[model samples]
Target chain A: MKRPFILIVAALTLLATAVPALAQDATPTPVPPICLNYVGQPDDIRTSYYMGEGLGYYASGEFSRAINSFTCVIFEIDANYAPAYMARALVLTQRSDYERALEDYTRAIQLNGTDLSGYNNRGIVYTLQREYDEALADFNQALELDSRSVVARNNRAVVYALQGEYELAIADLQQAIETTGIDAVLADLLDPEREEGTPPIRDYDLIEAQPYALLGIIYSAFALDNYQAYLRLTGSNGDFRIQSAAGALESRFTFDLRLDDGTWLLVADFAPEG
Target chain B: MRRTGLIGTRFASSLPLIILIFLIGVFTAAAQESPEPVATPDPSGVTVESCRELTERTAGALSIRTDAVAPFFIGLGDAAFADEDYTPAIEAYSCAILADPTYAPAFMNRGYAFFAQRADPLALADFNRAVELDPALALAYNYRGMLYTVQGNFGLALGDFTVALTLNPDDASAYNNRAVVHAAEGNYDLAMFDIDSALLIDPEYPAVYATRSAIYTALALIDAEAYRSRAGEAARYPNGSPIEVMGGLESAAETGSFATWLAFLTRR
Candidate 1:
């Protein structure tokens, strides 16, 4: 009786595994729609032409006409086109129509969850509305989709900074700089034997500079906060000076505070170290 | 004994409050005036020059070639365009295109002529053909981007500007155009970044300053609206006048000193 029971149990396990294998063989996995490179064009030639016309209107700064053209692309041709929704949402965002923009962005995301820009852009809308938790969640999801995305990291840092999570903000920004290769380019720029007429900057380098600028602002705020605390604790009348070095960089910042005739004077200076 | 004990307890609790009040008074007495720092100079205001005017001045350098006939016609077109004669410019550019159908610059220049005359469709066709003829022609992309921008096709415009920049990283006009598109899309952070890059490339570029002023004005208005919405009926002014608020915002926009403006608002 025990041997018969063992044989039945083994047969049942094999049937369960074989059934799933057969089902897997019968059904094919569906591919997700690509969103990042979505240029808002449709397969139909007429829709594409209208999309081009709408883009022309948008480029011309006739936002109302542009919006109308995009709407035509949506209503007249393909309602399921994610790019149209994304484009219309962009125009709505520019107009500060946050509600409609949110709706459009949400719709675009629904149509294509694979597009990281959808999440990043929607996160921006949330950030603008002061919906920090929602923004963070969107950013986190975006990061989960693409770990190396500098835009998501930078935007998430901004949200974190808004929420007063300074350390987290700093970490994210540092990661952004790393991912953007700003440090490597800066190192190359600092080389003394480099060829002449070679530009020390690129368009993307400007983007990388944002992190450095943000870091400076954060450090400045820290200096001010510390100064206030020092004043509260010591009640000092003498000039108070704090000097700090930027992380992993040769730049130094000095914050000076002086009291003169019942007035406080503060000055911050950035001096690069040799 | 109970009354004495209660008095001691009350005194102990009030001691920290007394100290806190004393500290606040001392700080107030010592810092009667706000902090003083060097002020940033006011930047130039927005320029009245149109986008086309700006682009024409900064348009990509005319493509030089060894072909004599096309170059001659191109020279004629350049002269006419420079003189603001759109008809002759268009005819000359057409002749250049006829002389060399594959010359991307001819198409781009003719497109410019058509654009000058407000013949957008013709200009777009020429620009499109120019891009098709030479995918690497940065000027063609720039002109087409400008046309697309005019036609309200920002996605294509952005694509064109980005392509132009990738082809020629030193093109300050491309940076400025991309900045304008970004600003229009409500991506102020990206807009500001592009503007800074443009200024770095060409500090004397008037269009960049204009773009910066526009961005600052937009930001000031947004901040003002937020302040008003939050303050509601309890809004206060520095001098009890609404004009002061506008004045402060204008000053902030002109000077590009948002921090100063925010401080002014908080003080009110």
Candidate 2:
């Protein structure tokens, strides 16, 4: 009887310990983040309405009135409204007022550092001003916020190419192509559903095409340099022939040498076989 | 033998208590395995009027009226619109368009008045004409986006809003409206990001606050539904009733941000 009682006591203790351990090991399910903040206010309505009016003015191509509307929102309604600055900057940019546009972009960035467009557009303006360093910095910052951003990478690549850093430019462009998969972008552009109506081409198609065009230009430059160097070194009056061919997935370019006697020789082919 | 008998009796007497302890431990473990749903605050006050107000406030303006008579008619139209007189505003804008057939603002303003009167097809035609006359006019795109939102064409609405933002990045209202659309689509993360962006642009935007509250309420209800589904028949509030999880349907019936959100959802 005593032995049986001891056994029962041990069994109960074991079960108690094991149950809690099992509970502790169980994983909790994830839930979406919830916000608990103020709602139902009249002032927000009026302010948003005023902003819509300003946008309406902007859409109607009434630059001065649009500017005034946005300015009113900034000065009279809410000074902190970052969108007004951004809107005003856009108009300024359209009117070739880069100086004020820069100021507004800077202010918008200050208000909202996470907005990728602010950085990207500011970088573009800097590029337009020939401020390559500023442009590069802004593009880099934008890329840091979103590493897979093809636009930022492409913009950075443009700056690099402008600075004659072809290698870095090529690397950035290649990475962008990899991240976005140019084929997929092209597929979207060529999707049969788009043929139902005369829909405008998407920006992705244009953006995806840039790297290929840039790469071709860069490669052409390299090939041209080699041809020039060959001419200088060998003092040969041979005609250099360049031929381009397009494939289903890629474009191929080959450089060749032809003597006046009609003898052809392959010099170099930069593009990989598709 | 006598000592062993006493020990056995004592152990037997405590056996029931030991079993009760074991049962308590097991039940506690089982409870811990399923987390209780966090109580969500009621999102009760946001209204459809706020959204309507936002839309109504997007009145068109004629900034560069080249024609002499066009400017006067535009001014008249603007005054009529300000006085909540859609018919006269539409007429004045139409006269301005007649005076200067190429004036894009007249078309845009007329579209605004048409929208106010719920003449969607007419408003859409006017907006399309305005855009055709002046592709650079950001306000036309913004107004068209609002019309699209009302028409339940979210894709077109989003595209137009994007164009408006691209044309004028400072349009806080565009961000707010886009956020509203995202919330309606159950894209809570995107909704939160847009709402935050709107706040960054204008910290005191009341409509954004209302939208945020609606999003929160939606999230809470989603969480509650998830909990109830996971717990099945065993799920219950502190009261004897099961979790009362009213989706966007019930909330939409109430006038406010949720109602606006429901409109978007149902239309989609």
Candidate 3:
């Protein structure tokens, strides 16, 4: 899905650390090579050559130069190269040229319907443009492609948050966090053939905390909306407080409201999935 | 004479106390015999205070007692971590660290546990201590670099990532991480190079694919803009036709002069 910017921010706030002793591992790791080699395809060779040049200029911070190289690949090299269109779209997005970016994304999607990122990124652009319905549709399409995609769920949550649908947002965020937890648990439970080659399992709490906080934020926003609606109906103000207590596997988000009678009443209790 | 002989035989046969004392003496002697040594033979010449240690050291040759020590707790932590029982793993790692603060692996592992828990501050502190104790620990630097990158401290992140690469050039993850720094700086070329390096080291690594895809996409847009300047339409592509730009290329190739200029511009 369009890279989950929130998760990126959250991960930055909460991150894992490790980088040594991959030497002992036997697994064939995938590296980010130039990928110029193509078997039995002379045409693909030309494509990679241009792609490599485009990538090089892009990496050098020459945005305009990079765009030209990629465009040449798209127009002069091969019009069917979905990756070239996708690449150009990314640069356009970076430059805030959302119109062309959206077009490129759509073309990329048209060329390769199986790639979910195209839909997800287009959905992001739609959301940015305040086209909530279209954004939701694209996110839905992505989820249909992969039901278990956490990135799609999170992006959809963003759309929901924008629409003041806090409940759905909370649900999506909680699901993303829970999925991560489940993944970590499952990874740990499985036995690898060799200990040295296996990637170390991460701690669940590290991954769960920020999403949990985000869930709480959504709950708070929802509570505020309810309180505002109540105030509008009663023509009076009320005191409200949000309290949270986290357990080993779950956390409780409670909103307590004090009426004119001086008695505290429970308004909302959201126990998001861990 | 026969009656006197019978009386003597009866007196000899009626010595019950003497017979009982003789039996007790035999039983006592058996009880007092030295018991066989309980201590098992140790070919490794290592003294084991607990059965846990004995069994672990002897590979199940001996198991008679349960032991809780630094190494034992470390093993427990490692097991819990493998099971994704992060809470128990952290607890076990804590115990290991408590037992032996100087143990670099314990600190490193505990730091990892903290990281998994999303306790960044705790994780960072543990990582700091781990690196302090063991300067050669490349993983600590790599992790710290990840943390720094997330925190948006690209400078520190770059330093840590570079250090990790210096220590182990084959660390594909470090190369990928360094690429993230380059990407953040808008140096897409270097970013792609680093990612490519990572791919070369570990061709199966999945994360680099995403990064590579992103780089390719970003470059396309950036270069598309450059296409405008050459076409003399600084605002946009001519009639929104990207194909029009290729018109001059065929003629440029024949003349060599225009082709050289186009190549320089494209390469630039």
Using TM-score as the measure, the top candidate is 1
DockQ, candidate no. 1:
0.01
Candidate with maximal DockQ: 2
lDDT of each: 0.62, 0.61, 0.60
Ten residues in sequence with the least summed lDDT for candidate 2 chain B:
B59-68
For every model in order, the fraction of real contacts preserved is 0.00, 0.03, 0.00
TM-score of each: 0.39, 0.37, 0.34
User: What range of 10 consecutive residues in model 1 chain A has the weakest lDDT sum?
Assistant: A265-274
Instruction: Give per-residue CA lDDT, model 1, range B108-218, as digits (tens).
Output: 888888887878978887776676666667777788888888888887777777778777888899889988987797766567777888999999999999998898777
Estimate, for each residue in B1-268, the C-alpha lDDT of model 3 and write its tens digit. 6534543464355346324533443343234324232232221132323333422332111110123344445554554565576775666556545555665556677778878777888878777676766666677778888887888988677777777776678999998988888788776656766787899999999999988877766665667777776667646553333344445555667777554234334332
Pick the winner on TM-score between candidates 1 and 2.
Answer: 1
Q: Write one digit per residue (lDDT tens) for candidate 3, span A1-274.
A: 5579888876765543323434333423323333322223355544543454344344435556556656765766578777767666766666667787788889878887876767777787777777889988998898888766666776777678768887788888878777777545555657565476565565444433445555655665666566556655655333332211122112222333211111110111001110
**Candidate 2 lDDT over residue span B23-81, tens digit each:** 54334323432222222121212133432332233331211211124444565456557
- Tens digit per residue, CA lDDT, model 2, A56-117: 55555667666765675566556776766776676776666777778888987888787666
* Candidate 2 Cα RMSD after full superposition onto the native fold (Å): 31.6
State candidate 2's DockQ: 0.02
Give the local distance difference test score of model 1.
0.62
Ranking by lDDT: 1, 2, 3
